[model samples]
Target: MKIAQICPRYFPDIGGVETHVKEISERLVKAGHDVEVITTDPTGKLNRRETINGVKVIRFRSFAPGNAYYFAPQIYFYLKMHSFDVIHAHSYHALPALFAALGKSERRLVFTPHYHRSGHTAFRNLLHKPYRLFGKVIFSRADSVICVSEYEKRLVEADFRVAGKTVKIPNGINLAEFKHLRALQKDEGIEGKTGKEKTLLYVGRLEEYKGVQYIIQSMPELQEFRLKVVGKGPYEAELRSMAKSLGVEGRVEWLKDLSRRELLKCYAGADIFLMLSSHEAYGITVAEALAAGTPCVVAKGSALEEFVDGTRCLGVDEPIKKEEIIKLINKLKDMKQNSRFTTESLTIFDWDYITEEIENIYNN
Candidate 1:
């Protein structure tokens, strides 16, 4: 099968969608399908084409307020020329999906919204009207809507009113890469903490909606652990100030964008993974960390709960408090030595199995 994936962002600009595109495309290529990705030029310089990890990638110029949502004519023009059995558009904000439908491509169109609106504050919630209007246009034209989680499936039905076929396929990870990371693991034990201190890791954009502040607030009480915050975003300065004001600056370690190799090291070195997002259509990082044999604690009432069961991870309430965060961290710290349970639970999300499931979807 020939597949064409359209997304607004790609590699060198790491995020949930970018990682999703890379993981899916790499698996598709490995499964004997020809996969091509079309994304925006984050550098603002137009490049005709490039390839990464056996997948062909094409970039076009686009301008927008955020790095992920871009306004450009090139995307529409590019779709008119390419032909494939499957044209999968990721994210609901980008206009390219609607343009591709306007082109009237005979190929099956699959739209995965990666819907995560709940995390936003009241100010951003007002934009839902436009988002709903956009959804009505594109989802109505789609052959199917591929939702990444059960929560996301409900969001599509309730919010978008998508009449087309809907399927729930959870986000996946490359388990072998994580296994390789385990082989090169390094210890990062802090001096003041005991040998039993667990390293808590948070890897993703440090945006306000991500609930990084809640984790920072937990640090004073979770004195037996160290927190490692990875990735960069516009709210870095404010988050840093919050940590200082909370008097937990010494307990937190901030890291910008990390290479894939460096990321796996963080995963392997850590005892537990923490993702305290206020909203998540699907938290792929939680799945990845679990696959790496690290226990995860994510927020409840969101898509992340669909990926991690109680055996591998714990789900805390949204608007999480410092006491709740500390309690959960202590629970995970106690189970860190349960190697058999962690390894067995995460094996289900290996890339090879995930790729096979997608292959079956395409074949159908």
Candidate 2:
């Protein structure tokens, strides 16, 4: 089968959606399917065409401001010209999906919105109201509307009225890679720190809606624990200044450009992981933390809450109360001491299984 995996960005630009597209595309290729990723490159520096791990990747120049809208009209022209058995559009937040849908090809159309329901900032959120008019095209044209979480599925159904076409195929992870990478970084002396008791981990883009500030504010009382933030975004400077003003600068470690092995080492070395994003279609990092046998505390109301079963992970409501969050963090710490972390129930997220499910959709 020849398939087109279309999205706003791809590998080298890390995020939940980027990772999802790359994982499924590569797996599809290994299954003897011919896969190509069509995406935008706002900076215009990346190659217009390239191949990574047997999957063809074609990038087009885009007009991206605050790196948000990703206005790339050439995408429509590209899609209209290409031929594929299926064209899978991704990320409702950007315009690439809209262009893909507008192409209105004869092949099957599949859409994975990875919808956040709204935007991360006031301006972006406001734009969503108008964007909804265009959003309908992506959903209405697709043969299948794939959602990564029930949280996302509910919103898609309620807003788009595509309940009949919508399907849930939650994001998947490499269950073994998390465990295998646990010992790689430290053994090679790439990251020299040890004795990480009471360490806290936060991994994702440092966006305002991510609720990372809430964690930074709690640092004074969480004096015993040091935070290791692992990702980059527009909010880094602001977060750093806040840390400095709060006198928690010494306790916060900002890291990015890390290899997969080093990142898993951070996950395995920490006592607890935190993903406080206001909205997420799904939380892949939280899944990775659990896969590494690390306890996690995630924000409620997103798909993240689905991972909280009161043992390996917990959920904290927004308005992120210091006492409430701290108590839960301590609770997870105690659970770790009691040997409560387990992966027996996490096989459902295995990438192999996830690829099978998606392949079923493409074939049908």
Q: Which candidate number would show the highest lDDT if scored against the true structure?
A: 2
Assess every candidate by TM-score: 0.88, 0.95
* Residues 223-249 of candidate 1: C-alpha lDDT, one tens digit per residue: 777889998988789988988998888
Residue 166's lDDT in candidate 1: 84
lDDT, candidate 2, at 152: 95
Candidate 1's displacement at residue 92, Å, is 1.3
Off by over 4 Å in 1: 45-48, 117-121, 180-182, 186-197, 335-343
lDDT of 2 by residue, 216-246 (tens): 9888888779899999999999999999999
Point to the candidate with the largest TM-score: 2
Backbone clashes in candidate 2 total 0
Q: Rate the local accuracy (lDDT) of all candidates.
A: 0.75, 0.87
